[model samples]
Target: MSKETMPAAEAQSYELAFHVLPTVAEGEVAEVFQTLKDLITKAGGELGVEEAPARFELAYEIVKHLEGRNRKFSSAYFGWVRFTVDPAKVEHLDEEIGGNKSILRHLIIKLTKVEEENPYFFHQAMAEQGKSETIDLDEEEAEATTATDEDASESETDSEVTEDKE
Candidate 1:
C-alpha cells in the first residue's frame, strides 16, 4: 500500500518496568528516572501512571556487562511507567533504554485493557504487608509471655504443696 493511502498506526498501551543499577547514587536516581520519562515523551509516547523508583533487594544477583567488565548486583531501585505509543516506535524506545548504563534491566510489554485501567503499586502493598506481619508477630510474642507466666505460677504452687507435706 502507498504511504499516503495507509492509515496511521493506532497508539497502544504499554508499560515499561525497569531496574536501576544500585550503584546509582541516591541523589541521581531521580535524574535517571526523569531521563527515562523524557525518552518516552521524545519518542511520541504519552505518559500515564508511573511509580517512582524505590530500593529493593533482588530475588537473585543480576549481572550486567558494562565498560568491558561484568558487574553483579543484589539490589536495585525498581519502578514502572505506563504509556501509549505507536507499535512501530517501540523498537526505538527499546534501543534507547537498552543503551542506558544507569538501567540494569528493563522490560516493555503491551498492556491489556484491564491492566491499563487498574495499576498495582508494589511498594505500597509491600509496606502494608510488612505492617500486618509485625502486628501478628507482636500478638504471638504476647501470647508466649503470658504462657510462661502461667507456667511459673504453677511451678510455685507445686513447691508450696511439697513444703506443706514436709
Candidate 2:
C-alpha cells in the first residue's frame, strides 16, 4: 500500500466580506460582484452561496485605504461571498480585491471546516428582529424625511450666512 495519509485534493474554506462604496450605483454593484465571482473561478475556487447586498452604517469612518489612496467613508453596501480555495492562491485574491476601487473594504478568513450554509444567515435572522442597521421605510415616509432634512439644511445655511455678516 502507498504511504499516503492525507488527501491531496483538499481545499481551504474562506469567508469573504466586503463593502462596496455607498456612492456606487446598484447596477455597478452587480457588476463588481460578477467580476469577483469570475476572479474566484479563474483562481480555481468554488463559489458558494452569496448574500444579498444590504445597507449598513460603519461604526467609524474608514480613513486608511489601500495603495496610496486615502478616503473617509461613513457607510457602505455590504455583501458576502463564501468559497473554497487553495491556500497558495490567497495572495492573488487579496491583490484582486484590494486593487478594486469599487470595494471600500474587504476581509478574507480561513475557516477551520467546511460550512455549506449561507454565511450571513445569522445576520439575516437578526435583521428580521430589528437588530440590524438596515431600515425599511415606506416610500412616502422616506420622501417626507428627505423633505424635512432639506428644510433643516436650508435653515442652517441661512444661519451661517447671517453669522458671516455679523
Candidate 3:
C-alpha cells in the first residue's frame, strides 16, 4: 500500500502508574516526574490528566535489583499519568520506563472508553471519605451520650416511685 493511501493508526488512551524509589530525594521527585512526562511526549504521546507524585507507604515491601544488589522498600512516591499514543509506540515507552533506575515499579494499561472520559482522583476521594467518616463518628458519639442520659433519668424515677410506695 502506498503511504498516502494507508490509514493512520488510531491513537489509544493509556494510563501509566509508577512508584519512584524512596531513595530519590524529596526535592528531586518533581524532576523525576518531569522526566517521565518528557519521555511520553518524545514518543508522540498527548498528555492528559495526571497526578503529581506523593509519598505513601506501600501495602507490602517491594524489592528491586539496583546497582547489582537487591534493595527492599516499604514506601515510595506514587503517581500516574494518562495519555494517548499510537499502539506501536507503547512498546518503546515501556522499554524506556523499565530501564529507569529511579522508578521502583511501573505499569501501563490501555484505558477503556469510560475510564478515559472520567478519570478518578483516588487521593482526593480518600480525603473526602475520611472527612465524612469523622462526621459520622461524632454523630454516633452524640447519640450515645443522649441515650445514656435518658437511661439515668428513667432509673432515678423508678427509684423514687419505689421509695414513695414503701
Candidate 4:
C-alpha cells in the first residue's frame, strides 16, 4: 500500500462508550469489536484502549427462553472504546452501526476541544488556583475570629469593673 493509503498505526485519539445486547455471548465480543475496528480503519483511523465490561441487571427481559432451557435472561453488557477516525468519515460509521445486530447501541462522537486536552494538567491548574483561594479565605476568617474574641474580652472587663464598684 502507498504511504497515504496504508492504515495509520496511530490516529488522533477518541473515546467511545459502547453497549452490547444481553443475549450476546462474552466469547463473541472480541470478533464484534474487531468488526468495528476494521470498519474504522478501512475508513482511515486507529483503535485504542478497550475498556473492561460494566454490566448491570436489566430491568426487563429482552427475549424469553424455552420453558426450561436456560435461566439466564436479565443482564446487559457495556464497555468503553477509544479510537481515532478520520473526522470526515464519522457519519458513515453511524449508518454502519445502525444496521448491525450485535450492537444494541453505539455512538461515535467527537471529543470536545476541552476533553481532547489533557485532564491531568487542567485539574492541577485548577487545584493550584483553589489552594490560593482557600488560603485567602482562611486568613480572612482568622482575622474575623480574632476581632470577635477581643470584643468579648473587652465586654467581660467592663462587667468586672462595674461589679467591683458595687
Candidate 5:
C-alpha cells in the first residue's frame, strides 16, 4: 500500500479595521494595545497596523459638556487600529467589539479581489487626470480667445472700410 499524507487545512486571514474611543495615559499604551491584541489573538488573528495610535485631529470641537465630563472621568481620545485575523475568528472578534463601548465603531469587510485595489493608486490616477485637464485651456480661456479673435476681425473690417472710402 502506498503511503499518502493528507493535505494541510488552509486558514484564510482577514484584515480588520476599527476605532478605539480613547488612548492610554502615559505609559499605559502597552496595556491598552496588549488588551486589544490579546483579545484579537484569542480570536485567531494577528494585529496589524494601528494607524495614528494617537489622535491626530479633531472632527469638531469637543462640546463643553462632553469635555467637562470627559475631564472629570478621564481624557477621551479617538484612535484607529487594523489587524489581520482568521475568517472564522472574525465573528468572535466582532461580537467582542460590539459588546465593548470603548470601541466607538468597527467595520469588518471581506477583502475580495476588486475591493483589494489600492485607494492610493486610484487617487494618484485621478490626480494625474486632474493635472492633464489643468494643462489644457479651460472653458473660460477658450471663450476669451474666441472673443479676442472676434475683436481683431472687427478691427480689420473697420480698416477695410476706411481704405475703401479713401
Candidate 6:
C-alpha cells in the first residue's frame, strides 16, 4: 500500500486492511494486530474500528514469500482497521505492514472522511444466519394463534348446542 503521495495535514484518515495466513493460531492473532496498532501510533496515526479476523478463501493461490521462505496458502484470516494519522507517515505505515511476515496481503486506502454507514468489513453472514433462525419463532407464534382460534370457535359451538338442548 505504498502510495507515492501523502499530504502534509495531520488529520487524514485511512483504512488498513490485511489478511493473515490461517496457519497462525488464534492465540497468536492478537499479537499481529497489536503490532499494527503500535505501528500506526508510532507513525502518528490514531487507531479506529478494528474488523475482527475471519476465515475466508483467497481468490487465487498466493505463494507467499515463495522466492525465499516459500509457502502456499489457500485461505486466511482477514482483518481491517480504521485509523487517522498524519499524511506524511502513510509510506512508513505501508512499509511496516508489508515487512511483517505474518501478513499475507495488505491494502491501505486513504479515506476522504469516516462515516458509520459505509460497508465495513465484518462477519455479516453469521449475523444473517442468526436472523434466519429467529423466523422460526414467528412461525411458531402463528401456529399457536391458529390453535387458540380453533379452540375458541369449538367452545362457542358447544354453548350454542347446549342452549338448543335446554
Count of steric clashes across candidates, in order: 0, 0, 0, 0, 0, 0
Worst 10 residues of 1 by lDDT: 1-10
Q: Under the 3 Å rule for N, CA and C atoms, how many clashes does model 1 have?
A: 0
The Cα error of candidate 5 at residue 146, in Å, is: 30
Q: By descending lDDT, how would the candidates be arranged?
A: 1, 3, 6, 2, 4, 5
Model 5 lDDT-worst window of ten: 1-10
Write one digit per residue (lDDT tens) for candidate 5, span 18-89: 444554454554455466667877877765545433432343334322334642222343344545554556
lDDT of 2 by residue, 74-135 (tens): 88888888888776787778788888888888888765444554354644765777765454
lDDT of 4 by residue, 1-166 (tens): 1012335444445565556666667888777777767777787777765554445555555553434653445666666566677655666776786567766656665555686663233334545786776443445666542434434544656555443443
What lDDT score belongs to each candidate, Candidate 1 first?
0.83, 0.72, 0.82, 0.58, 0.49, 0.75
Cand. 6 Cα-lDDT: 0.75
Q: How displaced is residue 122 in candidate 5, in Å?
A: 16
Off by over 4 Å in 3: 1-8, 134-166
Model 1 scores a C-alpha lDDT of: 0.83
* Tens digits of lDDT, candidate 3, 1-166: 1012124578888899999999999999999999999999999999999999888878779998888999899999999999988777888899899888899999998888998889988667766897777443445566533434434544666555443442
Q: What is the TM-score of each candidate against the true structure?
A: 0.75, 0.65, 0.74, 0.50, 0.44, 0.68
Residue 8 lDDT in candidate 2: 50
Model 1: per-residue Cα lDDT over 27-132, one tens digit each: 9999999999999999999999889899998877899898899989999999999998887788879989989989999999888788888999988888889777
lDDT of 5 at 76: 42
Candidate 3 residue 133 C-alpha distance from true site, Å: 3.4
Question: Higher-TM-score candidate among 4 and 6?
Answer: 6
The better-scoring model by lDDT among 1 and 2 is: 1
